[model samples]
Target: MTVTSSERTLLDSIDAQEIVSLTTSLIDAGGENPGDTEEATAKVLAEHCRALGFDVRTVEVAPGRPNVFVSIGSAERPGVLFVGHSDVVPAGTGWTTDPFSAVVRDGRIVGRGACDMKGGLAAVVAAMAAVHRAGLADEHPMTLACLVDEEDTGLGIRAFVAESEQRNYTCCVVAEPTDLVTIVGCRGAANIEVEVRGRSAHAGQPRNGANAISAAARIIGIIEGSQAELDANPDPDLGPATWNVGTIAGGTGTSMVADRCVLAVDRRLLPGESAAGVVGDLRSRIESAELTGSGIDVDITISMEMPGFLTSVNHGLVTTAVQSVIDARFIPNGRSAGSTPAPNGRFAGSTPAEFTDIWTASCDGGFVAQQMGIDTVVLGPGEIENQAHRPDESLAVQQLTDSARAYALIATRIAALPGL
Candidate 1:
């Protein structure tokens, strides 16, 4: 596909400075998850959307946590949607600068959420502004959804899916930090809590009580034994379904035999796996263990689950996104002189190539793909492994500009398709 004059106009209208300013503002707003402080970020996003003359709506998914929606064009038609999260993980100790400072140095913006998603969020909002400014709002429909609680449980996305049941979105682009590579699939995740119970006894008479900690250790061993089997059958793109024992707590004091133990396990799932199925299989395995005869009782529960998604690489959305990334790289204004090359040696202004990969980390895009049945792809600025959730997290300014341009291109191309 070729870039049209109108598309060029839209791309040119996306100012790099504007995107940087917005990103800085968002970073300064400070939405740290587990703190329930996303309202500040939502307000910043909503203000920007209103300033751009888009119809803005804020829906409260939880107390002091809102999802901001910015829309343009007719609601009656199917549209291209941009999804992003507003929350950031807590800024742990060890930062050279204040995590909320949104500092710019060495041509990179530094902050807590700068790379993980605030930068991506700014790019999407800037793209929408450009699309609206270039008179494209009347040409097609576009929506930008800024959600909360992605860093923790997926409360915002779950609420979005429930409320958007009547809307017909043809495709979704989750502006996650993909280092600009098109992501075709991701692993799903679930949090399983196992509680083991037994009778407590004095330390002097430990054998008189069934040891809950010992039973819990046995269960942990059972979980570990399943890993090799999962590793043997890994998904070609998303990798194997794996298990991680995140937390374990048992026993009150050394003076008495432990009566209870709780184990929190994180399980990554493949496309066909469900939380219920995993829990059932685990429960069955544990029940068949020797704990039944030892007066040990076990209870398992699924605290949270996020489904995985796989979009065909050949889909129009994926193809368009790939082309958009290539096109964005070639734009003179979008190239950063000081930008670092990707791990594969690709850099801005280099010979353009099509790159696609899968995310081991999941996102809200899975919800859109599975529940709404919309074709979805993950593409945005910054490196997930190297930058996101790391101290002094930062994103290159060039990436911010390129991502905005690419998003605008995607919005126009996908909206102008024949059937939609």
Candidate 2:
């Protein structure tokens, strides 16, 4: 589609400086999931939305952690919702630049949260401002939901949905750095701990006691051996389930036989699989291992679980999003604006050459779709490989402006849908 003068004007309304400045400001605020909280960033976002004449509110999802909600439409009508997480993972070591400097150099904004989503958050805010500037808010209703603990526990989104039982949203778009591609679904995540217990004994009398470390090793081997079989049955979009022992700790000293061992397991679940059932299966496997070995005690517990979800490409929200991407081409940067099958052949999207698909990793969008029951899609700037959770995290300058425009176009177009 050709760019219309009015559409060009709307896209031009998105100030690149404003987006960069806001992203920098947010990156400067500490929102590290465990060591820090999003309270400060949430306040900043609330004030920004309020200044634009939108109704905004902040709810504390946890101590020092809050979720900010902004709405431009009446509560009586259905609206579109934008979801962005304000929380970022802890900034581990090794950075060439200051983690929170939000430095802009070489056409990239570098910081801990720049790409893993303060950039996307800035884009959403800029888009909202554009929508307001063009008077699109008056014709269509929409909401922005800024959440906390997306890098860890997802209490913010859980509480947001619980509190919004009376409100209606036609669809949800999560800004999680898809590198300009749309994500229609995502694999779920569940963390489990497998504990092996045995009687401790002196090193001189090793035959007198069972070794927990040996039992744990056996269980690890079993898990590793099952990978091929697990990979054999793949989902149409997300492919196969995966498992990894993220952490393992046990024992006292080399002089004494180990008495206990604990393994922290990270499991990725495909759509249609229940977290409970998956945990149960893992527990059963550990029990079977125990039966075959020395009378070692074995137990499994699910530490956390986030549901996965899938939305068909033919769904209303997806089809509308495809058109919005085409319209976004008005401000072209040489990328195609039509939809096609992704290279992986698992999903479809609006890009000229790439199709939308399910994310291999987990995200809050999965929880939103599974819990809120709203049509959800993940779309934003920054490639996950380029920055997310990595040192010197950054977002391309071009991606920032283009994303704000894309989001503005999406919200405006979705709002015009009949009865939505």
Candidate 3:
């Protein structure tokens, strides 16, 4: 493939300053989940798409939150869906700077959503613009779906998948801060709640009550035992299926035997593991315990579950994304000078390399691949370890710029491929 001056010019147009401006505007809006809406943020993003000659649609997922879906090129052929979310988690305490400042200081854009992932969002939008400006939109169909509430319940992506099932999307590329690596798979998450009930009795008469706390303790032990066994057989790429007892509460007072105890569990599922199977196994273990049959009531319930997703390395999307990352590395001086410092053994600079892996954390890719059945790959900018949900969260300007170029190149290549 020969690189044309026009292509180089368009790719060069995706600079750090533009991305930083967009990201700063977005971060300044403070679209935090559970309270704030993304309407304003969506509007900011929509203006960029409209200026790029892309058709933009806003679907209200909630009162003030809207999912921004933009389309470029022809829909008659199979297209690529670029998935991202605009909402950020609440800016918790201990921030030296304003979390919503979106300030460019020390070569990084500091803000709450700068890395996790308003920066990625800006990159994808800019990628689409660059592709269109380079006349690549006519080469294939492209759709940019900016979602809401990815930090909490994934209602935006879930709703988009449900409503757009009939659309001809062959694959999905998610910009999820993979440090510019192409992610092949990600662990799913299930939020489980367990309740153990017993008759309360006076603390002075310990034996009079079938201690619910004791029953809950046994349940916890059972989970720990199962977790150990599960960890023994870890996935080659995904490591292991794991579960943690996140929260437990029981007993009202020191002078009383606790009558009820509730445990909140966070279960991380491997690619092939089903939520039902894991929850069933836990319920069976609790039921089989001697205390359960001895007047203790053990109830298991699944509060929420997000399925895991995996794409074959041989898939067209995966291969194209890998090549795109490799291509992004050659962009001349695309990164800010001395912008990124190596943190935690991970390369801090934007110099690209093949660092594909199954993300240890969960994301909307689960819903896109598992629920929508589209081959989805998690590829994006920024380091997940140090930046996400951390104080003074920032995104490297170079990473953001490089990610846009990669996304633009990948979209063009995927568009030219034969239909699935």
Q: Pick the candidate with the highest TM-score.
A: 1
Please state every model's RMSD to the true fold in angstroms.
Answer: 3.2, 3.2, 3.7
On lDDT, the stronger of 2 and 3 is 3
Mind giving the per-residue lDDT tens digits that candidate 2 earns over 129-175? 88877887756667888998888867787788778454588888998
In candidate 1, what are the lDDT values of residues 1-420, reduced to their tens digit? 566777778888889999999999999999998899999999998988888789999999989999998898778888889999999999998899999989999999999999989999999988888888878776767888899999999999999998844456889999999988989889899999999998899999999887889999999889988888899988877788999999999999898889999999999988879999999988888877766557689999998999999987777787778778767766444544344353235653332233677888999998888887888999999999999999999999999998999998888888756554
Compute each candidate's TM-score over C-alphas. Answer: 0.93, 0.90, 0.91
Model 1 has an lDDT value of 0.86
Best by lDDT: 1
Candidate lDDT (C-alpha), each: 0.86, 0.80, 0.81
For candidate 3, give the lDDT of residue 316.
Answer: 74
- Please, what are the lDDT tens digits per residue for candidate 3 over residues 34-137? 66577778888888778768889999988888999998877777778889988888889989899987788877899998889999988888887777776767
**Candidate 3 residue-wise lDDT at 222:** 96
Q: Candidate 1: TM-score?
A: 0.93
TM-score preference between candidates 1 and 2, better one: 1
Off by over 4 Å in 1: 164-166, 331-354, 416-420
Task: At residue 361, give the lDDT of candidate 1.
Answer: 94
RMSD of 1: 3.2
